[model samples]
Target: MKIVKSVLILILFLGIGATAWFYYPHYQIHKMKNDSMEVGKDLSRETYLDYYRQYSKQDIHHLAIGDSIIHGFGVDETENLVYKFSNQLGHEINKTVHYTNKGKNGMTSTGLNEMIKAGLLDEAIKTSDIITVNIGGNDVLKTAKKQDYYGAVKSFDTLQETFTKNLTEISMKIKEINPRATIVLLELYNPLPADHQFSDLADSLLPKWNVNIYEVAQQIPSSIVVQTTKVINSDNPQNLSQDGVHPNSAGYTAITTQILKQFSKEYRKEAV
Candidate 1:
């Protein structure tokens, strides 16, 4: 009995030590990223000026909104989806299109709706010919990550309801601002690979969140949902950045391809 108790105590201490060793650095990195790297609620005055200013210079405009993926968090402007999407789209349309990114890191669906209410996207939305919104990832992820497996799924219903209402408002607001423009809402992708610790949670939760997005898209005219499942999983080595969450250049490329395909399909339908 004494030997068994001693062994158990030693195991507990070793387990705790291992856990702290692994988790402490991760915690610090998360804290640092939260503090220094990401652009938060304050959309800079310069970015605003540039957005509206570019509108006057171009006949076509593409505005991006939502989270870090849309913002191209770690990557440069050239490698970001918004930039690449605009360039490639411009080629197909045979016209120059200026792109504006209003995507902030860590933005949620409710945050997007609030930003619209705050008039952050007023003039840009009013002038944009194309608007691409990538939202809801953080919203569901934040909620899902907190709960156990079974509980996490059950919690989705409440979030889906709120997400539906918030997303519908966002779409409606965009339509009110520019009734003629095309809107593309990108679907949420599971960034965790099967090998990842969080893969099971992320894989199960993301699709449920995307279903709400697609259903909302169906309600809005001149809107479409682009498939992004191919890019979000870490199994696709080209898909993720160093962080393994946000899209890398190749992942952005894949997303842009899908968006452009959707745009082309919509354009043909409209032309008919």
Candidate 2:
């Protein structure tokens, strides 16, 4: 009877551990979403742009590079985040925001690092006043769908290590090329629907992946990490395209707003 009681106790402990394992990620996600919503609340866009007007040039050269998000895949040329961001920013600051996009479909963090090292983006990086990076979605998606949860988690751990290294190298290299340019790194958002099979796994891992992105931004000068999880998640299915991976025009607009808000907040911090 003592042995039976011991076995039951062990089972109960294992159940509790399993519950915590799943519940903790969801808790992190909730906290992150709340924090994202609070960002830039003290500063308005008008105020931020007014501050920019004081220090920015009459013409702004914007360079966007990364995967399909940067490339404006699954959306019209005018509807992409880059276009929306430049247009709105230019109008607000009264500057000519000329942009050159080097976004390629299916680009990964490793590929971006290789390109920067190979000097493929030298001229663009050097001449740009602003640069936005949106790579890593492909990296996350590549490992998030494994059939075994443990296997997927292991793969993501390996991927995160490589991704962090690559992102750090990429940001440092870009800063080396253009010390004055502001680098905006977009945080990866979970694209899986809440009801999807891998949704829980994605929720479990996305916060960690985004943490790496944030850490790299902190280490690099003139770098900003823009949070997109609040605006681009499974809850907003209408924002996504039919493919369910890429954002539609509306989704791009939401992302562009987040970028502008975060950029302006950074500006406010410096001005204050």
Candidate 3:
């Protein structure tokens, strides 16, 4: 009994020490903000890759794929959303829930479709119990509307059709990869006011695009859609970055919070 107690105490100390070693530098880097590499210094890119390598050996659940939004544009930590959402799900389910963020900046559904066609989807979907995606923002915004009012108005219809087709293809590809994976697609956030007249057109079209996303999500049998339009459209000043395109730190936190809430619900149901 004494030997067992000694071993337990040693184990406890080791766990505490390991936790501090891994997280202390990361905590300090976040405090600075300008240098992400400094914030992530303790875990080098090699270490980050190593960690993922280790995680792949375990049972994976809760995978994510998308553009810079899931890549955490303003959030200091790359693992910020992925870790938080996974932990929430793991706790609620009383089972190990692993998350992988397969997010790339400036990627549209066209890029995602290409990745799927190229067989890159296996990295995310092969072992995932759930998969979440966000796309179509870039596809809708690819065409630069001239300052002229007529040009912008004329481009809207073409952009709308392209957006719909690309997203539909992305959704279909995801379904093809893993039929059993619980797929969820996060609708695109509203773009900031670019021009007086164009802003109005964007406002009108944003909701319509979100509606299309909802319609597409419903078409998949075991799928869900999480609408972020309201959160992004809120009057909170901290919600947008300086460029007004991506979410600011506060906005990213809000988005993470919403994802965690949904993950908790599904995870809890699985636990029962």
lDDT of 2 at 130: 84
Q: State in Å the error of residue 101, model 3.
A: 1.8
lDDT (CA) for every model shown? 0.73, 0.80, 0.62
TM-score ranking, high to low: 2, 1, 3
* List of clashing residue pairs for candidate 2: none
Regarding lDDT, does 2 or 3 come out ahead?
2
Q: Please provide TM-scores, in order, for all candidate models, with all chains considered together.
A: 0.72, 0.82, 0.66
Q: Write the per-residue lDDT of candidate 2 for residues 43-92, one digit (tens) a residue.
A: 45333455557654788889999999999998888999899999989987
Candidate 3 segments exceeding 4 Å error: 1-60, 78-80, 145-153, 193-198, 262-272
Question: Against the correct fold, how does model 1 do in TM-score?
Answer: 0.72
Name the candidate that leads on lDDT.
2
Candidate 1 lDDT by residue in tens digits, 1-272:
99999999999999999777545644543453233223455655122223323334446888999998889999999999999988987777556879999889988889999999888899999988789998887876677677764565677778778888899999989888888676878877877668877676665556556666766665565566777875566668677888877888888998888776555433211101
For residues 1-272, what per-residue lDDT tens digits would candidate 3 score against the true structure? 99999999999999999777545544543332222113243333322223323344345577878788777665666435565566655555456777778888888777887887788877678678777788877665554533344554467667667767777777777677777666767867765654445565566556555666666665565565664665676355467788787887667667667755543332211110
State in Å the error of residue 119, model 2: 1.1
What C-alpha lDDT, on a 0 to 100 scale, does residue 11 get in candidate 3? 100
Candidate 1 Cα misplacement greater than 4 A, ranges = 1-58, 144-154, 197-201, 266-272
Q: Which candidate is the best by TM-score?
A: 2
